[model samples]
Target chain A: MTTEDTPNHRTRVAAERRGKTRAKLLESALLVFAQKGAGAVIDDVIAHAGMARGSFYNYFRTNEELLAAVADEINDELLRAIDPVVLRCDDPAERIACGTRLLLHTVRRFPLYGGFMARLPFPAANSGLLGARFLARDVRLGVATRRFADIGWRVGADMLVGVMLSAACSTAREPLSPAYPDASARAMLRALGLDEVEAARLTALPLPAFELPPSSLLRRAQLLSVGRD
Target chain B: MTTEDTPNHRTRVAAERRGKTRAKLLESALLVFAQKGAGAVIDDVIAHAGMARGSFYNYFRTNEELLAAVADEINDELLRAIDPVVLRCDDPAERIACGTRLLLHTVRRFPLYGGFMARLPFPAANSGLLGARFLARDVRLGVATRRFADIGWRVGADMLVGVMLSAACSTAREPLSPAYPDASARAMLRALGLDEVEAARLTALPLPAFELPPSSLLRRAQLLSVGRD
Candidate 1:
C-alpha cells in the first residue's frame, strides 16, 4: 500500500503535462484556421502547431475533431468577449447601441475573425451574422427600459444583425468612416422606436473599449502560417 | 458583284438561326447554374439547353466562359427586373422602401435566383448586392423630399444591403412571414429618420405586386438539373 501511494503522485503529474500539450495543440489549430479559411489542409494545422504529425494523430483522432474544436472555441470566446458590457450594462439602450457598435468595430479591427465570420461557410452562416444568440436579449432589455418603441424585439434584432454584417464586410476592405459608428448606431436606435434627439445622444455616448482575444493567436498566424503570409 | 449581293440574303438568314441557338443555350446555362451552383458540369448545361455536346462548344469556348456569362446575366436580369418599379416611381421614399421590400419578398418567393444570389462566389459579390447604381439615387430622392433625416445615403444603403442579404438567406429555406415585408419596411423607414406614423402608413399601404422573371428558367431547372432534386 505504501509503495502504491507514491505512484499516484507521479501519474497525476504526467496527466497534467499531457492536458497542457492538448490545449496548446488546439490553440495552434485555431490560429491556422483563422489565417486560412475552413477548407485548410490538416497537415498545415499540425505544422502550424509546431507539433510532429504523429503527435497530432495522438491527440485528435481525425482532422474533423480539430476543426470542430477550433470553431466551437472561436464562437464561444467571441460571444464571451461581449458579455461584460452587453449583459452587465445598466442602461438597456446602451446595451443595444454600444454592444452593436463594439461588435461591428471589433470585427473590422480583427479582420481574420470578423471577415471569416461575415463569410462563415458553416450551415449556420446566416445565424453567424444575425447575432441570434445575443440580439433578442439586447432588444428585450431596451423594451423593459422603455427605451425602444413597443415593437417585436425580433424585428429590431434582425435589422441590427443585417447592419452588422454589412459593416463588417466593408470593414474588411477599409477602415470604417469615422462617422459610421455614430450614424449606424443612431439609425438602428431610431428604427427601434427612440426619438431622434435621444437616439443621436445615446449613439454618441462615449463607447467603452473592449479587450480583444489574446495577441498570441495573431502573432502565431503572422509568424508561422506559410501560404497566408 | 450582283451575284454576291443575291447570296447575301441567304447567308443573313443562316446567321439569324445560329444567333437564336446561342441565345437559347445561354438561357439554359443560367437555369442549370442557378440550380447546381458554380460547380455545375458542362454536360448539364448542354442537356438543359436541349443541345448536343458539339452545339454547346459552338456557342461557348469552355465551361468557364458559360458560367461567367450565366452569372452576369442572372445579376443583370435581376437588376432589370427591379427597374420598372424603382426607376419610374415618382416618390423617392416609395422607390426606396417598395423596391427594397419587393426585392426581399421576391427573393424569398423565388428560391433559385435568390439563393444563388445570396451565395454568389464572384469577385464582384459585394457589388453584386450593393445595388450601388440604384441605392444612391433613392437616397437622394428621399433627402430631396425632406422625407429622410439629412444624412449620408451611403449609410442607409449599406444598412439596406445587409438586410437584403439576411432576408434572402432566410427565404431560401422557409417561407417568409407575410408580416415581414411591412414590418421590415417600417423599421428601415424609421431608421432612415421618418416619423412613426408616416413610417407605419407607408409600410401599411397595399404593397404593389412584383413580377418575377419568366418561368422558363424554373421549368428547365426542374426537368434538367440533376442531384439538386
Candidate 2:
C-alpha cells in the first residue's frame, strides 16, 4: 500500500474526522437546546446536524454530557467576549460594573447562549466556571480596595448569580431595552453595597464594544451543511 | 325512622367526611412532596394518607393539581408568618428590611416548606405571592417618599427578589448565621439605591419577633394521622 494508506495516516484521518463530527454535534445540540431547552434528545441533535444517529456515541454518551460540554464551551465564549474590555479597568468597582454590564449585553445579544447558562447549577457553588470566576475576582478585588462592603466572598458571588439569574429570566420573557442591562448592573452594584449615586453613575458609564469569539470553521461548515440540506 | 337517620343529617355527615378526606389528602401530599420533591405521585400520597387509591380522584383530578394547591397553601402560610411584623414599620426602608429578614428567617427555620417555595417560578415573576408582595409594597412606598432613589418599582422588586433568592438558595445549602439575615437585607437595601451606611444601620435595627401562624387543627390532626398510620 502507498504511504497514504498507511495505518498511521488512516488513524490521523480518523481522529480529525472524529473531531469535526464532535464539533458539529455540539453546535447542533446547542441550537436545539436554545430552541427546546435541555430536554431535546440525541435524535433532535442528529436531525439538527443532519448526522447519522450511530455516530453520536463517538462524541457524547448522553444528552446531559452533550449539554455540559455546551455549557463549558459557551462560558469560554462569554469570557472571551468580556475579558478584553473589563480587564483594562484599574478600580474594582468599575471592573465589577463593566464586567457585569458586558455579560448582560452578551446575554441580551445572544439569548440562546445565555439561556443555557441560566440553567446551569448555581454559579457561585461552582466558582471555577468562567462567569463566576471573573465576578468573584472582581468582588475580591473590591474588598481589598475597601471599595465594597465586606459581605463574605461566597455570599457576594451568590448574590451576583442571583442578580444575573433575575436579569436572564426577565429578559427571556421579553426583549430587554437598551437601558435594561445598565439598570440591572447598577442594581447589583447597589446590592453589593455601592452607594446609590456611584452605582447609578458607574452603570451609566459608557461600555466598550465586546465580541464573542468567531464561530469555528467546523461549526460554520456543519451548520451550513444543515442549511443546505 | 330515627331522627339521627334523617336525610339532612346523613347529607351533612357525608359532606363533612368528604371535606376531611380532602384535607387529609392535601396534608399527606405536602409531606410526601417535601420528602420526595414534586415527583411523588397520587398513589404515594394516597398510601401515605392511608386512603384508598380511588379517593384521590374525588379531591384532585391529577397530581399536578394537588401540587398547585400545596403551593398556594404554603404561600398563604408564609404571608401569615411575615405580614404582621413587616407591616407595622412606617419607614419604607425599615419596612422592606424587616419583611425580607423575616422571610429569610422563615425560610431558614422551615426547611421543607422553604425548599418547596424555592422551587416555584422565578421569584420576581410571581412576586405577588408569599413574601414578595410585602417587599414590593414597601419598595413602592420608598419610591413614593423618594427615600429611595428613582429606580422603578419593578427593578427594586426584582433586585430584592434576587437577594432573597440568593439567601434562600444559600441557606438551603448550609445553615445561615444569626447575622446572615441582617447582612443579606442590608445588601439588598444598598442594591435598592440606599446609601451603604443607612442600609447597614437599618439592618442592625431591632426586628420584631416574628412567628409563623400556628398549624391549623386540620393540618396537625392530619399529620397525627400519618404518624399513627
Candidate 3:
C-alpha cells in the first residue's frame, strides 16, 4: 500500500528479474554448447545455469531453441559492435577489409564466442544472416565500382567466409599474432580481385578501435568465466 | 589339424577378418560423428556398424580412439588420391593451384568424407599432417622460387586452408558448378600473391585426371551408404 510498493513498480521489478534469469540461461548455454558441440543437452544447460528443469522450460522448450536464441543475441551484438566501424569506411573494399580484421580480432577477444562459432554449420552464402547480408552488399558494390573484379558475389562471399571461418577457428583454439587479422584481410582482398598493391594498402589502412559492447553475451560469458575462476 | 586348417592359414584369415571389422567401425564412426557431432557414443557407432559391444571393444577401446583412427585413415586415403596429381605439376604455383582444385573436386565426389572433415577441427599450419606437410613444401617452394610473394608460409597456408575449408564444406552440402574448383583456385592464387592473369592461367592449366583409389575409406564409405540405400 505504500508509495514504494505500487503495483506498477512491482510489475517492473518482476519483469526485470525475469530478464536476468533468461540472460543467465543464455550465457550458460553458450558456454556449454561451445565446449560440448551440438551434443549439449537441456539437463547440462540447466545444471550450468543452476536452475531447476522447470525454470529452464519456462524460457526454452528445447536445446535447439536455446541455441538459436544464443546465436541471435550473439549476431545482434556483433552487428551492433561492427556496423559503426564498417559505416565509417566509405570504400567498399575498405569496408570489407576493416570488417574482416575487426571480426577476427573480436573472436580473439572472446574465445567462448569463437568456439561456438567454429562449431556452427557454415551457412550458405545467401542464407541472409545479417552479417552475410552486409558482406554481400559490400561485395556487390565493390564489383560494380570496379574496385573488385567481376567475380560473382557468391564466389566473393565464399572467399571471405572461408578466410573468416579459418581465422576464427584458429583464434578460438589459441592465441595468434596481432598481425593475423591484417594478414588475413590482405589475402582476402587479393582473392577478391584487388591488385597486390591495392589490397596491401587497403588492409594496412588504420583500423578503427573496436571493443565488445558492454551488453554483449560474449562479454557477459567472459566475465562469468572469470568469476568462476 | 587338417591341412586346410593349418596354423598359418588360420592366422591369415583372422587378421583379414580383424581388418574388415576395424574398417567397418571406422566407416560407421565417421557417419555417426558427422551427423551427431562429438556427442556420438560408442553405442551409436556399434549400432550403426551392426556389431556387438564386445566386438566393438575388440577394435576400439574408446570413442576418441575410434575417431582418431578414422582421421588417420582419411588422411592417408586423401594423400594417396592427391599426391600424384600434385607431383605432376612442376611449377610451384601450378602445384598449389591444381592441388586446390583437385581437393575440392575430391570432396564433392565423396560427401561423407567431406561431412566428417567439416566437423573435424582445423589443423595448425605446422601440424605436420601428411597433407599439411605437402602443402607446406609447396608453399615454401612457391615463395623460394619467387612464384609467390613472401606473405610468410603460415599466412599463405591459412588463406588456402580457409578457402579450401569453405569450398569443401559447400561441396559437401550441395552440388556446385564444375567451374567452382578452378574459380576457387584462381582466387587462392591471387591471395598467395600471383598476378590476376597468371593466377587465372595457372588454375586453368589442364588438370591431370584423378580419382579416389578404389581402396580408399571414402570410396568404401560411399559404397556402404549406397548399399544402405
| Evaluation by TM-score, superior candidate among 2 and 3 | 3
> Which candidate tops DockQ?
3
Query: What tens-digit string does per-residue lDDT give for candidate 3 at A53-84?
Result: 98998898876578768877887777787888
What is candidate 3's lDDT per residue for B175-229, written digit by digit as tens?
6677777777888888888898998888878878788777777788878776776
For candidate 1, what is the TM-score?
Answer: 0.71
- lDDT tens digits, residue span B1-229, model 2: 8978999999999999998887777778766765564346788889989988887887888776776677666666667767777778789998888888787776666555544444443422144544466877788889989988777776677667766666665654567777677777877787777887788899888778765545642245334545765
- Ranking of all predicted structures according to TM-score, beginning with the best and ending with the worst: 3, 2, 1
Candidate 1 runs further than 4 Å off = A1-73, A90-92, A117-119, A122-124, A130-132, A140-147, A150-154, A215-229, B1-71, B121-125, B130-133, B140-147, B206-209, B215-229
Q: Could you list the chain B TM-scores for each candidate?
A: 0.72, 0.81, 0.90
**Which stretches of candidate 2 lie above 4 Å from their native place?**
A2-67, A83-85, A113-130, A216-229, B1-70, B113-130, B216-229
lDDT of 1 at B171: 55
Model 3 DockQ vs. reference: 0.40
Displacement of residue B163 (Cα, Å) in model 2 is 1.6
Better of 2 and 3 by lDDT: 3
State TM-scores per candidate.
0.71, 0.76, 0.84
Return the clash pairs for model 2, or none.
Answer: A190-B190, A190-B191, A191-B191
